[model samples]
Target chain A: MKDLVPERYALAFRLYPYARSPDQDATAPVRHKAIVVGGGPIGLATALDLGRRGVPVVLLDDHEGAGLGSRALCFAKRTLEICDRLGAAAPMLDKGVQWNLGKVFHDDRLLYEFNLLPEGGHAMPAFINLQQPWFEKFLHDAITAAQAEGAPIELRGRNRVDAVIPAADHVTLEVMTPDGPYRIEADWLIACDGARSPLRNMLGLGFDGRVFEDNFLIADVKMKADFPTERWFWFEPHFKSGDSALLHKQPDDIWRIDFQLGWNIDRAKELEPARIRARVDAMLGPDVDYELDWCSIYTFQCRRMAQFRHGRVLFAGDAAHQVSPFGARGANSGVQDADNLGWKLALVVQGIAPDSLLDSYDAERVHGADENILNSTRATDFITPKTPVSKMFRNAVLTLAETLPFARTIVNSGRLSVPCTYDRSALNGPDHPEMPARTRPGSPCPDAPVGQGWLLSHLGQGFILLTIGLDAPESVMAHGLTVPRLALEATPELAARYLGGAKGAVYLIRPDQHVAARWDHYDADAVAAATARAIGKE
Target chain B: MLITTPNLTRPDESYARLIATHEGLDEAGSHALNARLILILMNHIGDDAVLAEAMRLARETGTEAA
Candidate 1:
């Protein structure tokens, strides 16, 4: 059993070896409040969120801990913010290399550069580049600390869920462990298994979408160099290793280089260390010295399941939707999924809200998945043109982009991932026209500095009524829920973000820090209705 | 708003100039020039509604001929 565990997990943290729980010896399967499968970033985060909310959750994983390779390297600002709320962002931000600038190149010439966050008073940077394993490791560390503090989060390693039987009220699962198979039931099951979701397959679901006819080889090389920490992408690179290449800096002086190897290549030969070193040598020239750390060839698809939720079973992360890795949306969006589902699922399990509230998770996340697929597909099309005419247009845009500023907008290396706004969600409540559109209903609450702490830190784990320059009750009880009021004097940044031209404003922020409703001024009835509507009462 | 009804004054001159701009270009160069010209014009017609209407008309004209 120990041999099956990857060495990477041993190198980093203690593995969660399978332990004999009493459920295995029970005559009847014991029921859990929430059961999350696949202890990747999404599952770990979901369990952590639920446990923090006092919901007993058990996470099952086939592997002991994080797998090999630095798969998902770019953690966006929104993901960091979500991690911050989960009490795991400090280690990530400390270890991950932060960068906001990206430069695009054609052959040997630099076309233009972009700053993801041009202006900022936000707490987190635009993005941070960290190895996926380290990202998962930090989450595990936070979970360990939470467990010490008596958070009811249990992680079962080597517990592979084999079969799922979903009933109206609970979902039964047959989990395989080193000790043998055990039966358990969960009120709600979250499948965060991954792009090739075994649970999704077990349910006989369809993952339908376009399969791009291109391949990329990621080679993480450890080296000591003084290259600026920024994303550099090249089209028709001068190195002649591939059609396109991307270079990014990661923690521990390791750099990630991706070469776009076209379809119909020998996968085994391309992964050979000698071949990979040759490509690296060409890209780096002779002066730079580096050691190859890890290499893998990947073929991506822009595909997703028809629906994220079915009966009592829910899907999150790559198990629900998938997109090309160009924009670094995979793990980032997965973390966002956990953030969105955590509070709602907790409420439903606690009987504070009806099961209908979970439907909003499906609606909002599906909206986010579609937006990610569209952007990544467009970026893939630009990077790998399917037709001669399309290639001509892409090259023309690149050529013009060298000199003209307008053409720069058309050049798409990869539109980096950003938070998705559920603009048309049914969960959205009233919006004040005078308020800024960026913070409208269904948008994530923009963070601002307030009294030596950030505004987002003030709004966590429950619904908040953030009133600025207005008088409201200390708390409001509506529909069997208590909405706490966070009154503050309007600061410059807060006014710009939450209150545009409006003199005073009131915002109803959901547990996930997304705005559910807003108004020009505080009203008790409006607040009650919006809070009810946000929980899917309407 | 997109003006499909005789919006351009001196239509002949405009057409002549468009043709004259590609006088010395090869097939690939001519195609690139046309793409650039289309991009510039699309930027000038920044309104999404107007640009979409023009794009639909352009595609429909090709399909109609086909």
Candidate 2:
């Protein structure tokens, strides 16, 4: 067993040693169907999704275990559903703090509280707050279990990719291990190597965007407190004069607190245990007993590479783009990136789809990144107003929110993460009238309770033809379409949400559960054409 | 379009409410609050042409006072 993780942090999963050191097999380069660099949540998810699709994947990571701290603590509902599909959400939900309400305060007075998920009947909550380490552990365990069950996923710990050479057909990687260095060839290379992506640098990709001038001090503390498991954000909190503070509860009696520090503050002094303790004491009152678990000072940047795809080398997660953590978009979007790329890459690797299908991943995720960046930038601007005028405007909005309903609309204290809809993709079939706008082409199929399971649970893993309140046309079977067709009775819930005012509908859904296209009536030709377009055959 | 004349039903009451909203503020704070109020009103009346005309009228009237 490799003892590579920090002793202070618990390692809940086993770390596998690197395969094929220089001494073991130096002459012949081992070839893999896909190689995912970085063993973070995104990389693990990509590998897991590919392995589940029967694609042989080799995952490399420089570190031997999970991340050092509770890096990204909030897991959005979409992300949880994606994890559930990958067989990792159960443990996360079981050991995570589930909450939907968030309270925002201006000074000591409470401004307002918002409910993320007011209605029920969904499989998961709006969000789950779990330590990133535990989340990664759950994913790691899922990958290990899948491998045990004959899934072709190879997790290589302490395997660092020193160099990347992109060829016409494949990518070559030089990996360094404890024993020595070895080379490997991959048909497709996925870079999930995080924000400071070494693979991105080796490939000479440029990441351009703005880096905010503000810094934040984050401390994860364990204490027994009666605070509710809800998100609390304070602007100019009395404890932290002229600054903002955020408090969120996690499992294991841990609370994550973030304090906004001006740009000129000393990072070292802010991170000191004594200073952190002082701040915590002031915030929680002098008598509260707590122990600091981890502390770090971070500056956020909103940036991305111009292109996520470079020939056979693809980028996902932080390696591809970065955003301020204000909106919890970082890890959530990365997970979505993995989910979006996994099935497309599987089809391409299996030679079932043209390589051009992978282009849709770039198009879709770049759109997603832009949305995340835009929302995060707005939240950051509102939280840390740079100019006096902007600050005054923000303060005025905060003031007016107490009485004016319209003013509350402009209050942006980190708009929570929601899955982006790929509304403008070229793969969507023609739109039809009398359909609900929410379930239109390129949008995620909203989950609703079916007979025993949710609607999302019934779709995906391949092209699915969902016919509601209608019989499958013989033309669909006559065409010998490989897409699985599921005929569902139009229950009231499904009818209202999916069918809308239409009596019936036929929906062609992508493998990632995004609605590729929908029509009021069954049209085999349209479905066939949309399927082809979806696989980049057109 | 821009409201060139007073449009409030009770101009004095509205003015008093506006002043009351900035009761505890000093001179600089009052000016800041007024600037913010203008921005909020501008956002509410989103028509650019109306905003431009209102700005022009305010500038002209202030110049005449000067």
Candidate 3:
């Protein structure tokens, strides 16, 4: 037995130390008090988050081993920051290739490369590309460290969970381990299983959305090129076809190419490596040679769970939605799901906040998932160039875009984000203007250089007040906003950005970086009222 | 490579760019700042709405959504 602190935060499933435990009997399948099924990024992140918080959890996965496969190459900056908070970010930072710009090309000729990283206040480069295996190893190590520290994350790898049924207080799960059948009970269950999540199906949840007719062949190829490693896309990309290839560097020498085979090609035959290789060889030129590392045929799909939660059993990652990877939504969104749920779940499991606080998880992240689905679909539509009319239009747009600065900027910006906010939600109100001609409440916050640290570095794990003055500058702040969360008034150096030395602006910020509300002057009443709404006090 | 510049490390040119992203600047000030920001960020990486969103989200919500 280990100490209470370590016992509370151990990882659950999917990964186990290769070394035999100092205790010989560790191989026996011990019944867990809480269970999380599936060892995908979402599941593993959840398990690690739980263990770190001292929650006894059981993790199960059907995979033969850890994520050794090649998949999702571009890990977004936001995801890195989230992982940083989870304590796995440092290793990830070192392992992946930080990228700032990506170029688009057609027929080996230049089209446009979008530069993705520049700051408002982001901590890392916009995104990094690495083989999923390398990143997975980093996460696996983090989970093990958290577990060894005594929050034991018990793993039952090669274990397929046959069924999970939620009872009033706990979940009854039937799992088939390598050693055979066993029944386990846990106080709560979280199904982070992927798109084929049996757990969600067993619960009778509907996975609803459109499955794209387009088939794409994604191949990891060893090719030497003079191209920048940071470049990600190529418009009119296919050589045999009009233009439809997206190429990106994975690590350094390895590049990934996703070639659209169109709706007409047999999804099976078009994806066969031999078929794909024949096409790749043609595109690279008759004389050029490229070696293949791994290949897979993919179909872009837009889908989401009808419900994220039913009582105690919850869902995250691909279990909730499967967006196309175009905007790097699938993996990036999953990590965000883990970040959002991790803290709230810990608080709920520890009895810090009311369980209802957990409901906000669905409210916040589901909306984001919906937004991402829309963005990815748009990106898919823009780049697809499938229909003859659409292809012609896309070609015209791209050709004209090169000559026209405005069009190029628009296309470029579409790759980046527009300031989006959830200010429209019930949590966000109409007290201020619909979008203050300038400062919209609940808008995405940009990064600002502030004293001691960048203002953003100060925002992890709590609420913040961006008022014109100091932390206790206003007489009203001395009384505190009605919102129950912690509020740290920014310093005088940074205070000028919000409300300042003058009758300046004041903003009530939520932990997730959505502007709850803002005002030009310090009105104790308005500030308190806005704060109340922000923390759901109203 | 990613460093948070504390306030206006160089106040002469940066003051206008800083004002536009946070609060409203007057016509001349806003135009000048936007142009400078466009030039500044274009050289590094195109800084646009995503940057605006992160800033607004951080300032308004107090905690970073990222």
Candidate 4:
């Protein structure tokens, strides 16, 4: 019998002694402005955002280092932009495989290939495939640097939360450390703990959704190959008797392969080294040299908590929701949740915005989670039909998609993750006439080349006014508003895209680079009202 | 310009009734029922040109799986 391959991702685990160990003389619990649990991508990103905003934060994680394997290998463009804002995108872009094209196959025949981003004006590409461990390591390094720079971010590893007590104004936590147990208090708690969140369990929250019966075997293998860096998905491939298979390339010559195993297959038997070797040997020619890096089996699920916010404790990432891995929505949506929550929490902590502003976080992210769940459920249902008629329709769609353009719309393997627009958000202000629909009130600001850099590089991290074809008002700064105004040169491309021949157009953009409002003329009172609405004061 | 703009007033109730019609049938039986319903609805419409236009509109506004 062949020996099973051991997991090979190397993560350096560092242990830190408990800083606030209990003493003989009783002392007041150390208070933090914000306490973030779970040091994964979402937690680290939230910590970085809060620290950059000068909000003191304490981050806790039970584990000492990165996760075991390359769990989430795809980072969407919006997520990379969020990471870029937090100062961690350069390492990811340098070490990740950037791919924007994908091919889908039905058995031996090729169905179609798609290009996610056909236009290339944006700074970030449509997608990058980097191992989850490397992504976390980059985030960790950023947090360390921020701490050194007096950002007041204390990352505590090997500290587990044993109890959670919520109050009207604060949340108390009982943390277990390497030395002993200690208690901590915080004005707000952000839970980024993963799918099986201990904090969520202690709070008695339940996820309300469906659990799929199908199981997928994921194997990461390292090999030197010349295959192009594009996603390849097969339905009932010739080498495997399963319903589906997926192949994706990651950084460092590692490739992720997923094979569908129907509901009743013995998972233990399927994971054996000999059986996995046979499967790999049949799929790739038997002569290829490869080494298994990691292997695991997972059942797909589409579930989420009814609400992500509970008083002072807010949940982000997999702790708040879980989706099937097909669409890459799990970690991507979590990062977006962090991005949305970070700015709002910072403002509230600094007393610049009221706590009611956090309600929009729940509303917007609930909408985002529902969107992810809906897409994930549809993709899973298409991939694994429950009824015979459903299966017939799915097959018919795939077969017809080969020649018919309309039928191609129904062929869904996975929709892939895209940023969600909060159009119905209550914080959105009035829209102006003749402006482009793409940059509507709740939409993220579209990136354009401004001189030598992208437009988004100049916008986010604070409220700003973008004026096109107009001069800034002389009294605009005296309105007691803290917004910085930028006047564009009305270049032909900018005017055509944003102004649409309407001169003197003004736009109010939020700290997260989402459009708050736009007007053909600037009114200081109106701008202040719009800014107030954007911060959830109205 | 838009003819088929939410004609059904009580869509949720109508949907429940429509699904209830196929409660106990097998795959082929359910498909036959669907065919029969389509024929009945087509006859109710009664105009051949309108039916053709409806078919074209339905085919044109293809369902996005996402």
Across residues A446-465, which tens digit of lDDT does each residue of candidate 2 receive? 88888888888887678898
In model 4, which runs have C-alpha deviations exceeding 4 angstroms? A1-26, A474-481, B1-66
Please provide, for model 3 over A361-465, each residue's C-alpha lDDT reduced to its tens digit, 9 standing for 90 to 100. 778778878888898777777777446555544555565455455445534212442333554665564344322333456554454566445555555454456
Report model 2's TM-score to 2 decimal places.
0.91
lDDT measured at residue A463 in model 4 versus the true structure, 0 to 100: 84
Q: What is the lDDT of candidate 3?
A: 0.64
Q: Would candidate 3 be rated incorrect, acceptable, medium or high by CAPRI criteria?
A: incorrect
C-alpha DockQ for predicted model 2 = 0.33
Better of 2 and 3 by DockQ: 2
Ranking by TM-score: 1, 2, 4, 3
Model 3: residues >4 Å from true position, as ranges? A1-14, A17-34, A106-109, A148-152, A241-243, A266-274, A286-289, A385-388, A409-420, A426-458, A462-469, A473-538, B1-66
- True-vs-predicted CA distance for residue A185, candidate 1, Å: 0.7
lDDT of 1 by residue, A10-51 (tens): 334445767878888999999999999998999999999999
For model 1, name the residue pairs that clash: none
On residues B1-66, what C-alpha lDDT tens digit does candidate 1 reach at each position? Answer: 778888788999999999999999999899989988888888888899999988899899999999
RMSD of each: 1.8, 3.8, 14.3, 7.8
What order do candidates take by lDDT, descending? 1, 2, 4, 3
Candidate number with greatest TM-score:
1
Quote fnat for model 4: 0.00
